[model samples]
Target: MAVSTRTSSIGGHQREPSGTLRLSVPTSYGHKRVLPLLPAFRARYPRVEIDVHVSNRSVDFAAEGFDVAIRILPPSDSSLVVRKLEDAAFVVVAAPGYLRRAGTPQTIADLQQHECIQFLRPASGRPLPWYLHEDGREQEIVTAGSYCVSDDVTGCITLLRHGAGLLQTLRFMVEDELRDGTLVKVMSHCAGSARPVSLLYPHRRALPLRVRVFIDFIVEKSTAWRRAKL
Candidate 1:
């Protein structure tokens, strides 16, 4: 769809897109990537005020009065209109400093011989499962850690940086580490497939102009991440 050049007016007055936008996002993704692009959105829509809640808890759009929400987790609520965004692949990683000290695992089964930081879902009190390519088949492997973070997949990166343990997380989250040699991919051969990313908003007859532009802005800027890096 093409955007119209026609000026928008309200009540006989030309108005710039303006309104308050309340939203929620996963903590680490919001802070590292999504939140950084916001200044550009602010420049485009000067009058739009944005309020964001960075949390692991699932949001109730109507019950909480939120306008939009971005989640890495699968959608559990069917009421909101969900627009899937970029998909991401996961990688098992460790810091170079840590690897030098503890040594690398030679095989997927060898991971048990090393320390591994794990992530858990606060909602279910269960650790997120790892799917590794093994013997020409994707197999599930349960990983454990001395420390765990609920809903914050990014924290695993921080821990891995400290030589806490090997952890599997989004490839994008550790790109800088991989590029600078601060962190090394542990098992590229057994890395997993892409996982869904999505944005959710109330299902309504029409979205407010302010909210609509934001949705467009985010989705438009997200094209690069949509490409397969694995």
Candidate 2:
């Protein structure tokens, strides 16, 4: 569902929101995207204390006492309200050195000829398939390589930087490297597939002021982020 981007006003005799906000988010996203925005959010909502929990596992909002969560995939539970934060685009990239040695791949079929780094799923302990858009549809392509990263997806990026192999990763993760020409994108024709990151919270008729403000803050920030990236 669409989240309203309206922010809470502190002016004109309105009560300033003050409380602890328990937020749960994925590790990578928490570090790269969310954490950096906290300082500004704090500046605006000075009295609101933020308690962040970074993990990949699904949280029990009621049992765990979490007020809000950010997830890459939508939850199955119907009781929780889901609002999309942003669509994270994944790109196929490799260091210039690695591409020079392996030869740049021009097509999706060409990826098989190169060493494609495999990112293992934390829950299943299996390699996560790469999703790419092709001919108006998304295709799941299972890739294999000499290197496998388990638990932490960022490990693949470390290997990628040292000319280890080709990697398909979230574009935001390698934005700096790509800008500096340290890494180069390949198979651009198949690169538009994106996964939606969403904000989740349990359904409640009346939410606390802190939670409501945090949700509005996140929605406002993410909308700007999407615009800036575009």
Candidate 3:
């Protein structure tokens, strides 16, 4: 069945869109990227109630009954409607103190001498490889860390701020830190990897009005922001 959008009104006065919107988003990205934009969304659709779930793990929309899922990586379900939103570029960063003590890595080989902070999967406890591009090609290097953190990307920012070690994370998350000289981008010449961010929802003949408008609102607004940036 299609969920039709209806504008809420009081005493025949025209009003904004009204409905409940369930949105699932990743922890770090949601706070850094999506959360700030939501106030605009709420203002546009005044009566719309949003239930946002922030998690470091994935949510199964089909079974979990989520109206939408915001993910950094590509959507796993091909049948669902997916919109590619951002490049979500990453940078290898570290506190200046750490770099001063351990020395900055100029290349992948140099990383072996530094304490590379690695992020392992919370569920599987497996260390993921880092993807870097340099010398005209992309390379995947198995990473090891003296200080290992599991699951959360935001944790990397916290640790790096304290002069922990080198960590590769989404650039947007650490923009303030980078700009304020709290963290420094290391080996920027070799930093060329990013994940695709997407808005995911199950396929249906008729999309919910709230979902439709929300997607359009954010996508259009984000496009404009990027344009202004360039």
Candidate 4:
């Protein structure tokens, strides 16, 4: 059976197609994790238009009129529905040349002596803390480095590849380079500390068709993404 419905715009003065859904995700999403699911999403919903905004900063979903957001951090408002997607692992990586020059740091404490490349949040102008695990305990190390770059993971990867310094980055970001032996993981003891990835949507009595469809699609795709590794 086929059914049709219509919804008035928030302003209540105009009506538009409700089948369109807008999504906001980190720009890095396309390059690493979310890119693989695009073709499948399009094939499943040919009529649903997906508008993707690639950004590093937090998105105001209600104010900005985005239907859903895939984010790394949890939302502040209790009114939003947050779903845990996965625990993403991060590692300390350095280019082969960099390792050769400084020598690989076999222990977390050894990081104190090497140059580090830091990723900064442009909105806050603060460098992200490097997280590591040691002896069954997790530690957030405040690193001192001469080089700091704004949310440019690609540039950091480039710097690391050229033997610039050590970079704390998600494993997925450097998987290929590690596989090819261009980059090597440093501080094996601190390798597994990771953050949780999440999907968030505004709380509502009922979700519109478009938002509902996309959320379901994301859940299905992400599940498959995890299962494939097994």
Candidate 5:
């Protein structure tokens, strides 16, 4: 039997892009979106080694040595290069059981009657306002509820999925549930608000080949993911 062996070089001229890529991403986004795409990225750039740090807090690029970072919100550091990857769309959703028991909310004002789950901001410990895009204008609704989750957004999602209450969350996080009828979308008229997800890296004269390809890869994939959802 004859087997073929592939070399890392093409005709002994160009070497395959190879190096360790240190990445930091939020826990929920990392688990749901970024981690799933890694197998394909690895298959394409087999020689590249990826060291991923999953956390919700900001990291110091120089201190942490992270080559790239994915952020759902804008990074405060002005020194690092920032590139907007995609808008993480948000939707207000509830488990069908919850909707059935609590009654579905039909208008932005109707949310007042429903048990809206709140996600508290880590920096300020204040509940994040629900951003609703209605009538071609964006409005921030200060929502209050008996239940609130902090630090990790996934906790809010868990409570929502179990029929605890309603939640406004990234569309990608609840896509499967929305499709499977486990969860149902409410307030369709005001569902277009989105959070910009950006990529961060240190400013350098020339980015390493491995980092360059990864940036391109993620941007491409994110575009496709957004289009599919649309």
Candidate 6:
């Protein structure tokens, strides 16, 4: 879609008209990876205004009138167009104090002996599963801990930082702390599964100008961001 670059004046003030874009994104560690792009997006398209709705539950983009939604897991519905943005690796992390106090787990089996901070989705009462990969094989392990909280990224990180049990979180969430030694990787050899970050939009014959522009921008910037991280 071609967007008009013509500048217009509103209320006697010369300003570009802002195009509103609605997005529904999952509230998870993955959001920490994608949310940083908003400033750059706004800088590039100053006329675009974005409204982000954060939720762990799947949203009906078409039904809810959302322009697009970014999700770690793509929707199963065939009517939506899904674009894979990047592959993210998950890791098991614990605060330095927690590891010093509880001792670090040397293997996947050792994890059973440590207290694990579990994430329970508020929308659904089920606890998130920790999928670990070791020796070219994958295993889904259900972890148990004394502390259980709703799926909030900040809360989980805070709990982990306060010497809570092992947390199975996306690498993107703790990259800074991991580099600075605040949080330590528990199982280096057992790098967990990699999940794809995807962009989902309605499969319309002609996408709105604002939606098309933002989608293209995200695809371009996401590719560059992923490449730079490598």
Tell me how many clashing residue pairs each candidate has. 0, 0, 0, 0, 0, 0
lDDT of 1 at 136: 91
Evaluate model 1: give its TM-score: 0.88
lDDT of 3 by residue, 1-230 (tens): 54324443459775556688889988887888788889988888787889999987788877877888888888767877888877778788999999889888898988887777788877789776777886788788877777777767687778889998888877878878887898889888888677888888888896767887888776876685344321
What residue pairs are clashing in model 2?
none
Residue-level lDDT tens digits of model 5 in 42-120: 8988999999998888998888788999999788889988988788888889999998798988888888888889888
- For model 3, give the RMSD to the true fold: 3.7
Per-residue lDDT value at 22 in model 3: 88
In candidate 1, what are the lDDT values of residues 1-230, reduced to their tens digit?
55432236658877677889897988867876689988988888888898989987887887788998998857988887888888767888898888888898768888887888878878887887788888898888987668877777777778889899888787778877788888889888888776788888988986788888888888887786676353
Cα lDDT, model 1, residue 224: 69
Per-candidate TM equals 0.88, 0.88, 0.86, 0.82, 0.86, 0.86
In model 1, which regions exceed 4 Å deviation?
A: 1-7, 10-12, 228-230
- Candidate 6 residues 1-230, lDDT tens each? 54443333447766553688998887763367557778877887787898888877687775688999888865788988899888778888999898888898988889789998888867677787888886688888888888788857668888998897889988778878888888988786785888888899888986766687678877887776577441
Report the error of model 6 at residue 91, Å: 0.6
Off by over 4 Å in 3: 1-15, 224-230
**Which parts of model 5 have CA positions greater than 4 angstroms off?**
1-13, 134-136
Please give the range of 10 consecutive residues that has the lowest summed lDDT in model 2. 3-12
